[model samples]
Target: MKKIPVMAAALSAALLSVVMLTTFSGCAKKPKLYLYNWTYYTPDSVLRQFEKENNCEIIYDTFASNEELYAKLLSGGTGYDLVFPSGDYVSIMIKQNMLEKIDKSKLSNLVNIDPMVLQKATYDPKMEYSVPYYFGAAGIAVNTARVPQYEKSWSIFGRSDLQGKMTMLDDMREVLGDALVHLGYSVNTANPAEIAAARDLVNSAWKPNLIKFDAEAFGKGFADEDFWVVQGYAEVVYEEISEEQKKNTAFFIPPEGGPAYIDSMCLLKGAKNVDLAYKFIDFIHRPEIYAEFTDYFGFPATANIPARQLKKVTPYYQAEELTNVELKDDMGENLTLYDDAWLTIRVGD
Candidate 1:
C-alpha cells in the first residue's frame, strides 16, 4: 500500500512539472522597444501596425522639449532604445557621447529622404548617429474671424491693438530666433550684440503686447478664442480646433522666417533593442508609413521625398515656405547667452 501511494505521488509531480513548463513557455513575454519621443508625436495607428507586424510591444515616454530630454538622459535615465531630439540637441547629445552609431546599411529606405532635408541637416548631414524624422518650424496661427487684417509677419506680435490677445512661445531659442531673423541676423549667431538686440526687441516691442509667454496652453487658448494670435506649431493649434474653425485659422511661417528644426530619431548608446531600433527606423521611412505620420499631424512631407505623393491630406504649410527658415545650431558654451537673455525676458516688465 505504501509503495503504491509513493508511485502515485511521483507521477503527479512529473505531470505538474510538464504542465508548468508548457504554461510558462507558451506565455513568454514579447520583446519590448522603448522610445522617448515628443508628446503626441507618433500616430496610434502606425504604432499599432508596427507592434502587430513585429510581434512586440513599444514602451513610449514623452518630453516637451529638447532640454528636458537631454536633462533626463544626462541624469542617468536608461532603457530608452530610441529618442527624438531636434538638430541642435542631436549635436549636443552626440558631443556628450549618449548615442549609438546607426548602421546605414540596415536603413534601406533612407534613399527616400529628401536631398534638400539632408543638405539642411548640418548637425548630422551624413546621419552618422541620427536620422531626420521631420523638418518644420513654429509659425503664427491667427484667428482670421477675430483678426482679419493682420499682416503675415513676425511684426504682428508688436501690434498694440492685439495686445492682451496675443502670445508668443516661452521658448528662448524660438522667440529670440524670431526676433533675430526679423532683424536679419542668423538664428545661430553667437554675436553678443546681435543676441542683445534680439533680447531687447522681445522685452520692449513684443512683450508689452503679449498676454503671457506660453508653450503649454497656447493651443487650448487659441481654440477657446482666449488668444486671437498665437505663435506656435501649426499642428498643435490646428488639432485643438474644429473643422469649421480651421477655415478661419491662418497658419504661416512669417516672410522673414524664424527658427526651423529637423527632429531626428537617434539610438541611445546602451540600447538593448538595437536590431529592433534599426527595423523601426527603416519602417518609419517607408513611403506609406511616412505619409501616414505626416497625414496624422497635417504636416508637409519635408523629409521623406516620395511620401509627399502618398499624403492623404493637405499640409498646414508648404515646404517652400521654409525657404528662409534657418536651423538652430548647437551653441556649445555659447548657449549661456540666450540663457541670460531669456531669464531677463521671463522676469517680465
Candidate 2:
C-alpha cells in the first residue's frame, strides 16, 4: 500500500512539471502586429528584420484598391493595427472619422520624409493621421520584343491594330483619369460634362481595343505575352517578369500625364497594438529600411528623402517623369457624377 502511494506521488509530480512547461511556452509566444496593406507593397527582408528586432510577429493582409479597403473598414472589419490607403481615400477616411490620429512625438524618423511628397499630400498635409509611404503613378508597359513600334502615349490604347492585345485597369478613377488628362482636363474634375466625355472616350476608343478591363492579373498576362500592352503600376508588371523580359519592357507615364497617388500608412481606430504600430511606422521611415523597401520593388524613394541616396537599384521610372501627373483628390459627394458615368461606360459599349 505504501509503494502504491509513492508511485501516485511521482505521477502527480510528473503531471505538474508538464503543466508548468506548457504554461511557460504559452507565455513565451511573441506579440503580433496586424497590418493591412496593398498587395506587393511590403518587402520580406524588411519585415523579417523588424520582427526579429522587436521580437514580434507581423500579420499582413492585402487589398487591391482603395475601394476595397474602404469597404472592408466600413463593414466593421476591426482589429487591424495599420492600413495603407492612397491620398484620396485618406481624405475620405478622415472625413468619415475612420482613423486614429498619429502621435508624431513617437516617430524620430519622421524627418526623413521628402518635403515634396508632403506638399502633394494635400489630403493630410500635416500627416496628423497618416504617414506617406510611396508616391507613384500607373503607366503603360509595352513589350518591345513583341511590339516593335508604338508611342509612349495613352493614345496607343486607341490603335485598332493593337485591339484585343491591350488591357486597361478596371479602376474607374484611374481609367477615367487617363482619358481626362489625355483630353486636357483635370483628373479630379467633378464636372458632369467632363466626366461624361472621359467615359465616352474610354467606351468609344480604348474599349474597342482592350482585351478586357483588368486590375489583378494584367501583370501575369503581360508576363505571359497574353497581352502585349498593359496599363498598371510599374512594380506590379515588373514583379511578374524576368530580367530578360524586363530588358525589353518599356514603362512610362504618358506625356499628356495621368493620375498619380501617394499611398500612406495609417493607424486604424481602436487598434490594439498602438505602440507596436508606431514602432513599425518609424522603422519604415528609417533611411536604410526605406532604401531596402524601394530597392526590393525597384521603386523611387518618393516619400523618404534620405533613402534616395541609399537605394542600390535603378527605379523602373524616374520621379521627374511624374511632373505632368496629377494627384487624384477626394470628390466627396461629387463622386456620384463619376460613378454614374462609369456605370454607363461599364455597362454600355
Candidate 3:
C-alpha cells in the first residue's frame, strides 16, 4: 500500500524541488548597493565586512578615471546606487544635476568628516550633493634606489634616463594636468590655448618615460622595482609598499602646485535603492570602519577625521608639498576643450 509507482514518485520529487526553488527565489533578494569606484582602490576585507554586517550585496564596479565615470553616468541609466567621483567631477555632476542631494538628516555620521575636507568640496558648497571620502594629492612616487637623482617635479617624467621604466595613471586629465603643472600652467585651466599647450608639452616632452600608462597596478611595478617613477594617486603608491621599500621609495607633491584631488561618494540621480546607499555611506563614515580602510590601504579618509589621526594613518607629504597642492575645478563649457585635447593626446596628434 505504501509503495507508489516509480514514475509518479519521481514526478512528485521534481514538483517539490520546483516549489522549493521558487520559494527561495521569490524571497526578497539582498538589496544591491552598486558602487562605481577606482579599480583596486577599496579594501576587499572592508567590503566583505560591510556585506556581512548589512546582509546586502555590494555590486562593485570600477572606473580608471573621473572622465570615464562621467561619460558612463552622462549617457544616463547607469543604475548605480552610489559612485565615487573626484572633486571636479563631483562639482560638474552637482551643477549638471547628475547626483542626488545629500539628505543630511539621514547622515548622522556627518560629524565624523573633517571640516577642511568638506569645505574644499566647492562643487557642492553646502555639502548637499556629495560627501568627501579620500583626500590627497596626485603626484609622483619614485624609487630612489633606482633613480637616485630625482627632482620633485613633473618635469622628471621628461627625463631621458627614465625611458621605458615609468608609468603614469591612464587617466587623461591626470596626465594633462601634470604636464600643465610642469609647464607653469594651472591644472584647472579652461583656456583652449593653455590646454593645447599642455597637450603639446605632453606630446613633445612627457612621453619619454614610457612602459605604459596604467591605473590598476596597485604600485606593484614600483614595489618590485619595475617602475623607477610612477605618477598616479598617492594612496595607491604610498601604502602598497612595504616597510623595507619605504626606505627608498618616497611620495611627494611637486613644488609647482601639482593637481590635488578629493574623491567623494554620492548617490546617483536614478539610484534603485537610495536607503541602502545611505546606510552604506553612513557605515563607511564610522570611525572604526574608516580606520580599517585607510589603515589597510594607506589612503587618506576625509569623512572620518579620527581615521586620519589613527597611529597607522600618518601624514603623506612634507609641509611644503602639502602647501603647494591645488585642486582641479569644474571647467564648465570649456570642459569640451579639454575633452578634445585629451582625444588629441590619445591619438598622438
Candidate 4:
C-alpha cells in the first residue's frame, strides 16, 4: 500500500514538471512579426537578410492598393505589426490614431535619411510617426516610336489620335488627383465644386483616349506595344521595360504638375513587437541596403544621398530632372470629395 501511494505521487510530480518545462519553452520562443505592404515592393533577399539579422520569423503579406490595405485592416481579418502606406494614408491613419508614435532612440540609422525627405513630408511634420521608404512620381511613359508628340503633358493622353493607345492607373486618388492638378486645381482640394470640375475633366479625357483603366497592366502593355502611352508609376514601368525597349520608353512628369507619393513604414497601435519592428526599420535604412533596394527596384529612395551615389552606375539616371519633384499632402475631408468625383467620373454623372 505504501509503495502504490509513492508511485502515484511520483507520476503526478513528473507530469507537473513536464507542464512547467513546456510553458517555459513556449515563453522563450521568439515573437513573430507580421508586415503588410504593396506587391513586389520589397525584395525577398532583403527580407531574408532582415530575418537572419533579427533572429525572428517574419510573415509578409501584400496588398494591391492603399485602399485595399485600408479595407483589410479595418475589417479586422488579420493583425499586422507594421505596414507601409503612402503619406496621405499615413496622415489619415495618424488622424484616426491608428498608428503609434515611434521612439527616435530606437532608430539610429534614421539620421541617415535625406534632409529633403525629412522636411517635405506633410503628414508627419517632424517625421515623428513614419519613416519614408521610397518616393515616386506619377508620370507618363511613352513608346517614342508610337507617339511622336509625346513630350507635351497629360494633354497627350487627351488627344483623340491616341485613343485606344493609352492606359491609365485604376487608382482613384492618383488618377483623379493628377487630373485635378493638370486642370490647374489643387490635388488636395476639398471644395465640392472644384472636385466636380476635376471629375468632368477626367471623364472627358477618358471618353475618347482610354484603352483601359488598370493598376498593373500599364507596364506590360507598354512593353507589348499594346499601348503607346501610359500613366504609370515610375518604378513599375521602369522595371517592366526590356533593355532595348527601355531605350524607346521615356517617363515624363507632366509639366502641369502631377501627384507624387512617398511610401512609408509605420507601426500600428496594437503592434505586439515594437522593439523588433524598429530594429527592422533601422536595418532597412542602412545605406547599402537602401541602395540595393533602389538599384533593384528602380524606385527612388528617401535615403537620397546614398541613392544619388548608386545612380552613377546607370546611364539612364538623370538627377537634374528629378530634383524639382513634389509630394502628396493629406486632403483631410477632401478625400470624400475626391472619392465622390472619382465615382462620378467612372459612373458617368
The candidate maximizing TM-score is 1
lDDT of 4 at 292: 76
lDDT of 1 by residue, 286-335 (tens): 99999999999999999998999999999999998998899999988899
Q: Residue 275 lDDT in model 3?
A: 90
**Which residue ranges in model 2 land beyond 4 Å of their true spot?**
1-29
Minimum summed lDDT over a 10-residue window in model 4 is located at 312-321
- Full candidate order by lDDT, most accurate first: 1, 2, 3, 4
Q: lDDT of model 3 at residue 149? A: 87
Indicate which candidate wins on lDDT. 1
- Score each candidate by Cα lDDT: 0.93, 0.91, 0.79, 0.77
lDDT of 2 by residue, 239-341 (tens): 8999899989999999888999999999999999999999999999999999999999988888888898999999999888887888999888998988887
True-structure RMSD, every candidate: 3.1, 3.1, 4.8, 5.2
Question: In lDDT terms, how accurate is model 1?
Answer: 0.93
lDDT value, residue 112 of candidate 1 = 94
Q: Estimate TM-scores for all models.
A: 0.93, 0.90, 0.78, 0.84
- Tens digits of per-residue lDDT, candidate 4, 16-44, equal 99999999887579677799999988888
